[model samples]
Target: MNSSAIAAGPVFSARDITRVYRMGEVSVHALRGVTMDLYRGEFVVLLGPSGSGKSTLLNILGGLDVPTTGSVHFLDQNLTQSTDRELTQFRRDHVGFVFQFYNLIPSLTARENVALVTEIANNPMDPAEALALVGLEARVDHFPAQMSGGEQQRVAIARAVAKRPDVLLCDEPTGALDAKTGIVVLEVIERINRELGTTTAVITHNAMIAEMADRVISLSDGRVSEIRRNERKRPASEIVW
Candidate 1:
């Protein structure tokens, strides 16, 4: 971990971010003034319960949604107010996302599934190289049905990292796996961040997973509850979750 101070400010900056949904008339506040900075090459873990704004925050950060009131800046670009076209380009060009589900196309081979993404990216690595990064070179042509959960997840990671994105947003990426399998998936993610220097943010309820991050931010009731810098982060295998 050895969290260095957020250098040169933040690569991704959120300020007093708030998101409210209106049904009929009354508002349901999903994000109640959550603010944070994600520095480049930083591994950040966000911990929170359901309905605690974790996913909402991630969505906003990933350009899938916008804040009800607040600001988000990616590098010097104002993501909060970016036009739809601009945001779409930003997402395609600079962000890579992984979710709880593998989301692989059942009919597509692992390499093809990954290629579906990289083909549209500006400067992507070959799908083969991406799969190799996740230790899936041998399974390149395997379909989702032919892969184990961990292996499928590695394919998802391969798809994400092939684009050389500036930021990687993962939402409960290992939520469905057993502890042992989850660690393997987490290890792949950690390795990608280390090797590519991607600014990574992972949202998970598993508290022990925080030990694998450079900084841990806990959310509660739509707000940031605590932020701690890990003095030293152990490898995923050393984590006791």
Candidate 2:
């Protein structure tokens, strides 16, 4: 991490970032000169249509991918300038990600799956404690194969938070589940954000979830189309479907 480079301010400061993908003679521009500031302990919801560059922005923020132009400064580390190893280490130390699919190992029990991450974390929480945080204490011994979609997603959240990361990046975490199942998963995520203060950013197509967030950022055509601040965020359970 570069100490002198990171300014004393927001957790993330992205300045005019652009991501371009080439397919032979054709090129795709995902993010076009997008700039933003993401604060710590903030629950932000990103809403956008398909191919609107929302996921691309989240990927850059998570250090899963780099921008072709501009910079992303995370807690003083220039994410766009790090090597593969540095990026990997940075992700291990500073970030946690939850996606649409619950990627729990089928052979491992819930506890063991979560334990896999804790073992590598610098100062990880106990696997059991993480599971308990997501209301899965009794089902810790169950395998991924035995759990429902919602339960599996809860396990994913537990695994992500076990590391006590500074950032939690979720991309359509409830996309694969039904309405009821998705709400349950959302509740778990909200609870984790409130309890752990994990500075969460959740990107989703379901605009209803925006009610539970501290702010909403809407993206269109690779730019921040709108940013709305909520005076008061309702509880996850109270969020209207």
Best by TM-score: 1
Q: Provide the lDDT at 129 for model 2.
A: 98
Please write out the lDDT profile of model 2 over residues 60-163, one tens digit for every residue: 99999999999999988999989989999999998999988988999999999999999999999999999999899999999998999999999999999999
lDDT of 2 at 155: 96
RMSD in order of candidates: 1.4, 3.6
Clashing pairs in 2: 6-76
In every candidate, how many clashes are there? 1, 1
Candidate-wise lDDT, in order: 0.93, 0.89
Among these predictions, the greatest lDDT belongs to 1
Per-residue accuracy of model 1 over 150-180 as CA lDDT, tens digit each:
9999999999999999999999999989899
Q: What RMSD does model 2 have?
A: 3.6
Taking all chains together, the TM-score of candidate 1 against the true structure is: 0.96
What lDDT does model 2 reach?
Answer: 0.89
